[model samples]
Target: MGQAAPSKDEVARRLADIGPGEEREIGEGVFMTMHRLQAIQPLGDGWHRAQSTEGSFSVELPLPFNDFRVRAQATDNVEMRTHTVGGKTPGLLAWSASCLARRDGKLGPEARAPGSDKIEVKGTPPVAHSRSVDLDDMTCILIVEAQGSDPVPPEADRLRFLHSLKRTGRPAW
Candidate 1:
């Protein structure tokens, strides 16, 4: 004979007991860290790295996600640059852009980008490309454009930049 399954109310109660921004062990070795808007589930095998700061935000990336250079940083903006390999364009690059709206040292909703329209400047030798996405509390902008007549970067480079972004926290109300 096996133990009876928990009732719906019991399950609800158990879930309700978990406070916001709390970390709870959900499996034999896995832990689920809760946030106001997201839940971070790190690997039990120790392959994930935490990029969290006290009372700030948290983000974990896979082990292979590395080798990036800090291109710019400010009180509200952070940009990281990395290049792609095995592509036709050897110098193709990507960026992880995070522009936060901070009020009283807490995150808040910022101006959202209108849409993802691939805008290209006319009459320019090198192609000028720009795209922006609204990340709830921030706006992530990625620009892969002309660099002194350099050939347009491969599409794979832009995809890599979009896939590399990981948000650790939620936007403020």
Candidate 2:
């Protein structure tokens, strides 16, 4: 009845349009691939938004997968909210730390905190970030953390993103 399931290599692979630094560079050393992951500004007092400039990623992962991203550009700069393509969902949770930890390749200040800061999160996925990007803030550090060997749900990944930019949201799961 259903079509033959796509192979891990198939579903995991990024679209052809996904370039080395534009979108999903599905392979090793991914930070160099997912560069536009964070190129936006604050929307409200606490909401950051990024359009699907290169389009959103929909890799078929195992568990409650990470759906999309929320920039969390500003808390006071905006309305202190998470603005994904679906605005804000009821089950959308948030992270308490930055996904830019050394574990993900960048130098994040986790020594001040206790948690691994790797941010192994879980919960329903978010919508999409946005369609317009702000290249001035060419911060693509989250790419590695998002597409790394470890398994951090997209829901949790988004949370960490929001928190780092001082955005706010309650934990869903």
lDDT of 1 by residue, 90-121 (tens): 34332223334333232222434433334333
The residue pairs that clash in candidate 1, if any, are none
lDDT of each: 0.37, 0.29
Model 2 misplacement above 4 A? 1-5, 14-35, 52-173
Please tell me which predicted candidate would have the highest TM-score against the true structure.
1
lDDT of 1: 0.37
Report RMSD (Å) for each prediction in the order shown.
18.8, 18.4
Where model 1 places Cα greater than 4 Å from the true spot, the runs are 1-96, 104-126, 170-173
Superposed on all Cα atoms, model 2 deviates from the true structure by an RMSD in Å of: 18.4
Assess every candidate by TM-score: 0.34, 0.20
- For model 2, state the Cα shift of residue 168 in Å: 26
For every model shown, the clashing-pair count is 0, 21
For residues 64-111, what per-residue lDDT tens digits would candidate 2 score against the true structure? 212232232131232111122222223333212112212222222222
Candidate 2 steric clashes: 21
